[model samples]
Target: MKRFTLRTGIRWKITIAIAAVGALITLALSLVVHSAARVSMLESARETQLDRVQYISRNAEAGRKPPMGAKLNDPELPQELRDKARSGRRGTYVQEKPRGLPEVWAAVPLGNGQVLSLHSQFRESANMMRDLDRALAIGSLAVVIGGSALGVLIGGQISRRLRQAAAAAGKVALGDPDVRVRDAVGGVVRDETDDLARAVDAMADALQQRLEAERRVTADIAHELRTPVTGLLTAAELLPPGRPTELVRDRAQAMRVLVEDVLEVARLDSASERAELQDVALGEFVARRVSALMPEASVRIVADEIVSTDPRRLERILGNLLANAGRYGKPPVQVDVEGRVVRVRDHGPGFPEALLREGPSRFRTGSTDRAGVGHGLGLTIAEGQARVLGARLTFRNVAGPGGTDREGAAAGAVAVLWLPEHAPTTTGSFPVIGVP
Candidate 1:
């Protein structure tokens, strides 16, 4: 196994720095004490040597200096004492005579100036210095090791909390919006994590509100539209045969038209509708519908327009425009299509100015002639379908083509559908239709 090393964070590193400094200071203090103690012991030993020499001088003859000048650093001493005197003890030192060890002579001084003395023993200063060094080394090492351990423990605690916060943030990024850091261990990240959680919660609440609103609207359309349709079916079943088949047929046809138009509008408003788009050359598509419905109405495909849409739905929208036009416009009803745009302008009295901005509204009549024949749902349904197909249905009162008698007071109604220029789709042409 590898040896463990201490690592620290910002806060703990500062603590460790302080601890290390304290350890160093403690070691320095120990060295100071060791030095002082050694100095004091040497001073005491020196005083003892002087006292011994003075006592010997008073008792016997002596000189101003010792006969040997200084024999404490004698090479013939024990190996341990020899190294200590030169390397450990740097100042004045004294050696004591060992009894019965050779002819060792004790130091004694003459009264005036002559000196006589010889000593052979070990230096105590050497032993004291070694003891001080050993004790200091052990104490200093313990202090440093303990301080470093504490610093690492503090750093580890901070690192763990930071890692937890990062893990929670990562989970949120992976689409687990519900994930969040716990609030129990409050710190710098507390406010920030709380803010993030609240933001996600708010987003979820908004999504649910939007979904509920859509469901409610769908339910409302189903309830309102189904009642009229049921009554119309029953009324049709009770219609007695004969009595001018024309009137009966027209009446039944009128009811059918109203029901179909309302249902188309409802489908457009339904959130579940998805338009199956396809590549369509709009020129041929519009021309076919126009020719089939109004062969003698002088229909014209004015441009080689192209788009992606439900061709059947487009036909229905144009069929509604043509029916409105044929009922109210001049004999030659006109149909024109441009690039991604289908325009049907009639040569009859124009639509009522009041309903121009209302685009597709229920029972909004554009004329009085067709009032009894059908409710004003034709334009509304067409506009709704055009929107669902990713397009806009616009109404405008404009002069007839060439602005001449062909208009024949033919300023009836002009409806234009601007379709989305979708990219080419792989689906087949003329798929099942859906309102926009």
Candidate 2:
């Protein structure tokens, strides 16, 4: 599946969102840490300086300079501060202003009214604050980067599923009625993905059913129109002996037949999902069928079998085969029924290889003779009926008198019709309807 490009996907959107949020949190944390760490360090520095002054105050002589004097020099001061010891009103004040240092001034009073002062340039506190700020910034950045990566990955997953759903939809739109998306989670996902997959499947199935229904309706309408036209033609032929009327009647009859054939195909193509369940007898059924086909035609039936089927539909199937046999056979249609197998052999030349290969497709007349012959749909209807009945109809080219390549330069096809085994317990009664 094709995923969104880097420039388009949710990965970056999520990453940006993560970074923004993480940055805010990290910034606040960094500031707090910087402030706390710097203040604590400064406090410690001040306490150490005060202790030095206290030591000097205890040892200092009333009239002489304190021994702690040298320790107050720039190198030894809290932050390399410059200083000089002098007594102040509260104590001895230490004064200094070392370049580039934070100022610190302090004094300790003596018991004899003298004092010690600790003063220095700007130093300690500023350095501690700077280091703390740097640490917080680094830590916050690391966290933001990690959060962004996670967010982008999550967004990519969501987008990928969505893309698959989109692809499935496209296929459905293009007439791929079987297109369906699998749920990322079992039993219909709890989210949009589940909804999308279900919707796609539902759409494809509904569309397929609708198309099938329309095809069937069209075919049924055509098939139903046939009888009336055929009747009308027969009535017209009886009315007059004129060539004009005869030609008109014949044309009308032919059109009616054509219309009927078209409709029959439509019906077969459009039949419901499955056929009606009913039992039919195949052996006696074949004998009666062959007998009815051509009177005095050499149609023989050796065995009688029975099977479950739609009687009306089954009649249509067998009638088509018998009619074709009578039309093309040289002498008489031969009908052989043994159990579930019904074989009708005719003296007609076998079908060509090409026709056999095409099998029982619609409109395959196998002959180009444009005479009174019906153009290919009867067999198509037969095939469709057989399919609906759960039976098999196969067409093969059989040799004539000389076992030569009848399929290559032969006349017609040898069609075999097979049904399931359904034997009647009694010869006179209709076989039991169907298998339990």
Q: Highest TM-score: which candidate?
A: 2
The lDDT per prediction is 0.61, 0.63
Model 2 weakest lDDT span, ten residues long: 79-88
Residue 309 lDDT, candidate 1, scale 0-100: 82
Q: What is the TM-score of each candidate against the true structure?
A: 0.42, 0.45
After superposition, candidate 1 runs with Cα above 4 Å error: 1-240, 244-250, 366-373, 399-410, 423-436
Candidate maximizing lDDT:
2
Estimate, for each residue in 1-436, the C-alpha lDDT of model 1 and write its tens digit.
Answer: 9999976565577557867796878878997988798667656765665566455445444333333434433445444434433352312244344552122223332434334333433356657777888888888878777777776676666666656656765554433434555542246644454565556556655654675566467556656766775676677667777666557566656655565565566565543355667678888887777889888766566678667787777888889888877875555577777777778876666766556756656666654643444467777778766755757888877665655244234356678888866532332112345789
lDDT of 1 at 209: 62
